[model samples]
Target: MAAVIDLNEDVHTLLPLTEHRPIGTLPFAGRYRLIDFPLSAITAADIHSVGLFMPESERSVQDHIRSGAAWNLDLIQGGVFLFPYVATRDYQNDDLRARYYENYTQFLRGSGSKYTVVMGAKNVANVNLNAILNYHKAGDNRITTVYKKLPLDRIRPTDWTLALSEQGTASAIVQAKERHDDQGKNEIPSFMDIYLLATTDLIDLLDDAAQSHVFRRLPELLRDYVLANNANAFEYTGYLARIDSIQRYYDSNLQMLDDASFQSLLLSSVPILTKSKNEVPSFFAKDATVVNSLLGTGTYIEGTVQDSVVFRNVVIHHDALVDHAVVMQGSKISTGSTVKYAILDKGVVIGPNLTIVGKPDKPIVLRKNQTVFRESEVEGSAHA
Candidate 1:
């Protein structure tokens, strides 16, 4: 089977962090990118042929997945193919639909595989695609979609929830907004935007979409197909974080600090892979104190860090304090500065003697390449 990774996610809520990079390339867990989860799942299933559909500006995605060597998708036959949309001011829903249909149809037709697995990059989960594939093969259904039971708050307004029949197949696809009466339910089956279907069936669905002039995203179209055909629903009881907003993103990263969550997601039998980086070991001063934090290589720490994830090459000065924060690569906390409940993007420098703090629910965000010298300057920072 071949695979398709869609990178066109709604990233407006993750601005500044996603302003320059696609959602797929966003740094996660102090090391892996969001795309690594799906790509690693595909690789673990021994699927070498893959296609990535990206938006107009995809330099970050290209830079990270260059030659697809890390995922073993650089083979001469049935290797990785990137289909990026050309930047245009006149782009509309119809144009996007036509473009997707054309590229998706061509990719599936050329993959030379009977089955195709399509997934998006926003939902963070370490799925065992091989097991799902085996289950799909054993069943007689033409389509299978994955879902996880989640709380009401975790379900986004745009997300699709399933109404399963007695046979465990999806009888209807319900939008989160339309389920206001079901708020009392403890948990709802939320779709993961992952689908597996025969190549010919997928092609037929795309052709029907083109003929019907339906302008919808690929995931939405797949949802409609599932409901119409009574697709089989596979329950995924793993740790899932649907990152459609800034609060979810922040919470998801910090959730990794928990031993159980980290072990279940990262230390599982199936490894999550990414582009390798070689750096020197991180240094810590004699008086430095770090507790319950994950630090990347090439870091120099001299301050008190608690409950945080610090990326590579970050520097925390002698008297600074980082509490419950996510510090990206190349960020520096000056000697007298204190950052608490915040996210510092790459190359951010907090000037001396400044204290920037935010509430636990709403973390302050410093965009990429920002240098803040005073408290007033931080007031202008983005707050999730």
Candidate 2:
């Protein structure tokens, strides 16, 4: 099976601290990037011929994914191909689904591959395509989409929702403008973003959609094409989070710091991939007190830190107090400064005797490269 990794859309919403950098390149857990998840998934599945679907991100994306060798995607037989958007001669309007179908069709036509599996970089899941491929081969279905169940409250801010049928079959479950009203019942649908399609079937559908100028999403187009046709659903019962916003991103990182059980789920079978940083070990000075925090490599702490994540190269000065916060790379907390429930971006500096605090509902965000004066109220600086 051929795996296609989609890196077209910007995933900056997830990494709010580093808005300048793309989500795929954002520093995750001390060393890895967000794109490492999908790359690791495909590598674990042994899918060598992975086609990266990137349309607009030409400059920065190329530098990051130069050859895909970091994730073992640089293969001899079926390596990775960076596909650019191929616009048709006659264009109607700006249509997202139309662009998706056309771009994928062009990729398939250029490269002669049989089976195709589409994946995105947002979700963090170690999925082995062996089971899904076996299911596809056993049945006569033309398409298969990956889905996982999510809580009702957690389902509000996401794009994909599962709308299951009585027969337990999955129908159209994609990006909805608003939650679809199904009478008085409040049944949510499974979000199906990752799609799998046969080479021939995908070509046919793309051609049809292109000719009709109907730029419907993959789920909607496929649903309409196959009125009574079989579209299988492969349930993924693992740890998965479609990191969408800043809060979710921070929360997901903190979740990885969970004790044995939760951490075991990811490192158990297929390990997640990321760029390796060979840095020195972390050091703690005298009188340093750290509690419930994730301290990365090359960090020096001499103060009290509680319930926080301190990334690489962070420094906590003497007499400083930090709680329930996220400190990015190269951040410094000076002496006598107190920080609570705030997100300090990379290279940020908090001066001595300053008090910066934020609540759980609304986290105080200090912009990148910003500095706070000593003995100043952070609330006033936030407004300024």
Candidate 3:
């Protein structure tokens, strides 16, 4: 199988986090990045070749997925290929597959496979593509998409929604809209925006969509394809979290604290792969008081930490209190600092005696390399 990942610009919604890096490289689950879920799924399907259509932060992407060795995509031939799109300020990639049609087509032509799997990375889930591929092969359809039935509010309003027929065929897709009914039974079929199609069929669809001029975006074009052609929908019954908003991001991370949710997503059948960093085991100082937290390698805790996710090489100085927060790699919480319900990105530094607080409804977020002064009150920002 040939695969192409569209690290779409929709990641911009993930603000401050996406401000400095692609969502794919955004740290998740204490250690792994967002892209690891899809890449790991592709590798599990035994698809050796991959073409990443990166439109932003090309350097950062290269650093994380360097040589694709972790995903077993380091093969001599048909390994990993990165296509960085360099366009003008007003450029929007939703109109076309790549900067130019020739670019995407070139990758398709040389992928040396019959089927192609196209996806967007914001949706985090550990799915087995082999099952979806088998469903496509069992039928004579030209395309197959993955979807789940859930409340519309669970995902973003811009996410694609699918209404399926009794026969399991997807009939119509709409830009997700909110339902006012707080009733627990109101659920809609939401598309995961993952597709599998034959290479020849994809080329044909591209030519058709271009000529019609009515469908320029890949998802819109595919929506029409499902309507016209015999496209099927495969129901994905697993943990699905679309990190389109900051609240959603924070909620999803905290949800990982649940053993069932954590086991199903990270310890599922497919092994999630990430760039390995060699670091010493975490050290807890005698002055530390920690409980119910996920601490990564090289993490040094000397403060009071409860119910948080701390990444590698982080330093929590003495007299600090971190409660119900997510702190990324290389962050230093100075002595006498207190951070609650916050997310500290890479290399962040908190001054001595600083106090940052947030509610469960709105968590504080400090971007990469951000610094906070002592005795500061960080509230109402939903962003720190």
Candidate 4:
């Protein structure tokens, strides 16, 4: 078996600490990366040949992936290869076909494999593919995708939501708002934003999708052609969160610190693995006061931090106070400044004595190397 990670350029919606960096390489959970979840899942499933569809812009992703030694994705069967740009060479090079070729070539590289599991990296979860693959083989389905049930009322119209039949088979894909609960049971299945496809069947599907560019997302394209025609789904009831929006990214990180129940949910089974930072333990000065926060290694907290996430190499000055915020690596919180409900990206600096705070609905996002004077709100008021 093999796993494919779509490292598309547009996946930057994950709000990476470094703007130019790819979402998968983005520092996550203080020590791990966003791609760790999916990579770990593939590793645990004993799937060695992992195809990472890296875009040309973010060559750093290719460099960092580094032979997949960190995640044990390096196997004799299939090497973790950074796929080259073939879309431009191919005739049917529209968005849909480009993606098809991208996935197809990656799978083609693993031609001997029986099944291919396509997944997104930004979402933090440990899904047991062994179960899903077993079920798929048992059902004799051409295509199978991992679906998570969603609360209908909570789903928005534009957000992608799945509709399943009485037998729990995915029949129609619809807008979250347009979803009706009255049909048999109010079961709403939302795609985990991940999929599993038969190796031979996926190649055939991609070949067909290349001809017809009606849909962009593979799941939607498959639903229109495969599922709607043949009917199948492998639902996964597991802990998952798509860390797309900035708010969701900040909220999920904070939730990791505060919610034990949520933490247990993910850590309970299918442990997620990541490249070890191998940094020294966090240092807290005598002047530092921290409460209910998760401070990563290599952090030097001399100031006051409350309910926050302080990543590696963060320096909180003696008098600075940070509350309910996520401060990325290599950032400096200067003396006498107070930052609340904000995310300071990598290399960010808060000038001495500045105060920046935003409403809960709209938190502030500061780019890298940007500085805001003490008691000053440098950005995001207009957005707020």
Candidate 5:
């Protein structure tokens, strides 16, 4: 079994949502969180031991991944370990690098595994690390990176790039600049932020990084190491949806409506594991109209829902309409209100006769536990 290192990127893009929890604990797909896929992938690889190094508040993450039983990480021998931020230093400083070095070395030294798989968990993809490990074991490279070749137009500016050599070795790591001014023929290979390496070798790299004062994240540091030394690249051809912004998250959820996309992810050989919830069946009223939407259990739907994802224990009152939106758990859509092209966080309440609307491109997000009041009619003479 390989020792796994799940590191936080210190990415602050997913604001309001991530205000209270780490990126891994952010909710997704109505029933699962962002961390579920990565944990599932880790378990699928049969790697029982993992060290999740969090860079921010980890209470929510801990709560979600409690005992790690769902992913078979509750073994007595080697199980999930939480390594929260312990060093007082800037994320991009030498102290931070040394901090990672300390934790990583400590973890790997006692893991009883020879190989390590390091990755970021925020991205959405059904990665088969078993294949990646096979690729690594078959090659003589010190590090093997997993990357996906996406079209330039489909690629986002924030995505990282990996330029591979003719021998499939990584030659360069490129950070995507601003969007292309011309739509000319320029395709880029986006790095999947996943790597497989020998644990001892990873320790050696950490020591080297500490000595050299390498402050960048592991991916950037690994890029430099790969350039100087021989490292392989594992090309991944699969569905990849990275949820960074609200728009992307909303879009990704909506994209699940497609059979191919939905089937490719959730229907993988290794099922996505999430914390179990004890909830009863959803109740839909006779007048409730739902189309092309996902409804979680214990929900009472008395309104019209279309192209949306509704979570557990939610109440959609009569005469309410939800369209092109995402509603979280314990939220209530009061009667005679319309929520369109918006996202309501957990425990949000839409008051009666309110119409909350947002543009298709920029969806309005109501914070958790918020209550939108009904719009009042202005008493005035008409056509004065």
Candidate 6:
């Protein structure tokens, strides 16, 4: 089976962290990027051919997946193909659906596989696509969609939830906002945005969409198709952390600090793979006191770090304190500074003796390459 990865998800809520990169390339868990989870799942299933469609800049994505060597998708026979949307004056006024359909149809036609797997990057989970493929092959359904039962509060309004029939098929697809608790169910079958279907059926859907002038994204289009066609629903009983908002992102990262959650997501049978980086080991000074934190390589820590995730090449200078924060690569917390419940983007330099703190529910976000010398500079920078 071949795979199609959509990277066109909205990132406005994840801005500052997503300013210089796509959501797929955003740093996570000290080392891995968000793209690594889906790509790793695809690789684990031994699916070699993948078509990644991106709507914005490809520089960061290209750099991270360079040749797709990490995912073993660099083969000459069947490899990863990147389809970046190019905006030209000829199609300036036209909706992106035209370009999307053209590129998608081309990729699907060239895949030469009987089945196709469609997925997105925002839903963070280590899914075993092989199991889903086997399940789909056993059934006679045209499409098999994956869903995870989640609490209503965890399901965002933009996310889709499925109403399953007695036969374990999707009878209806409802948005999280429109969901009604007629049966008094606290948890709903939240769509994981992963689908497996016959390549021919996918092509037919695309053709009909083109003919009807529909402009929905691939995932949304597939959602409607699933409900209308009564697609089979495969329940995924695994750890799933949907990264839809800043609060969710922060909570998801911090959730990794728990041993069980970390093991469940990262150390499962399906391994999460990422690009290899060669760097020196992190260093903690003699006076440094670290507790329950994940530190990346090449980091020099001389402060007190607790319950935080610090990325590569970060420096916590003498007497600084980092508590419950996510510090990206190349950021420096100067001596005597205190960072609590905040997210410092890459290349941020916090001046000495400054205190940057935020509440537990809402963390302060510092933009990329921001250098704050005085407290006044951080007054209105919180985008919580």
TM-score of candidate 1 on Cα atoms, chains taken together: 0.94
Give lDDT tens digits, candidate 4, residues 69-103. Answer: 88876666676867654343443457645665656
In model 2, the worst 10-residue window by lDDT is 375-384
Clashing pairs in 6: none
Which one wins by lDDT: 3 or 4?
3
Q: How close to the true structure is residue 278 of candidate 3, measured as C-alpha lDDT? A: 86
Q: Which 10 successive residues of model 4 have the least lDDT summed? A: 375-384
What is each predicted model's overall lDDT from 0 to 1? 0.86, 0.70, 0.81, 0.72, 0.79, 0.87
Comparing 3 with 5 on TM-score, the higher-scoring candidate is: 3
**Per-candidate TM-score against the hidden true structure:** 0.94, 0.83, 0.91, 0.87, 0.91, 0.95
Error of 1 at 14 (Å): 1.0
Clash pairs (backbone) in predicted model 4: 353-374, 353-375, 354-374, 354-375, 355-375, 355-376
Evaluation by TM-score, superior candidate among 2 and 5: 5
- Model 3 TM-score (2 dp): 0.91
lDDT of 3 by residue, 1-384 (tens): 899888755666678888868877878888988899999999999998898988567677889999999999999888888886645442354455334455667788888789999887888898999999999898667889899888646756677777666787876666666433335657777788799999888877776655553425565677788878757788898888887888888888877878888888999989989999888999999889988888889999899999888888999999999988999999999999888988888999998977788888878888789887743435443334
Task: List model 5 lDDT by residue over 12-121, tens digit each.
Answer: 77666667776777677778888898898889888978988876687887888889998889998889888877544564666666776788778888788878888777
Residue 362 of candidate 5: its Cα lDDT?
77
Candidate 1 per-residue lDDT over residues 43-79, each given as its tens digit: 8888978999986559989999998889888898988
Task: Give the TM-score comparing model 2 with the true structure, all chains together.
Answer: 0.83
Top-TM-score candidate index: 6
Best by lDDT: 6
On residues 1-384, what C-alpha lDDT tens digit does candidate 6 reach at each position?
999998887889898788778788888999999999999999998998999997586789999998999999999888999997654343433456566677888888898989999998888898999999989988767899899999867777767788888788887678878866536777889988889999988988887776654356677688788777888889998888888788888999999999988998999979999999999999989999999998899999999999999999999999999999999999999999999999999999999998898878978889999998987788543321
Question: Cα lDDT of model 3 overall?
Answer: 0.81
Local error of candidate 3 at residue 189 (angstroms)? 2.0
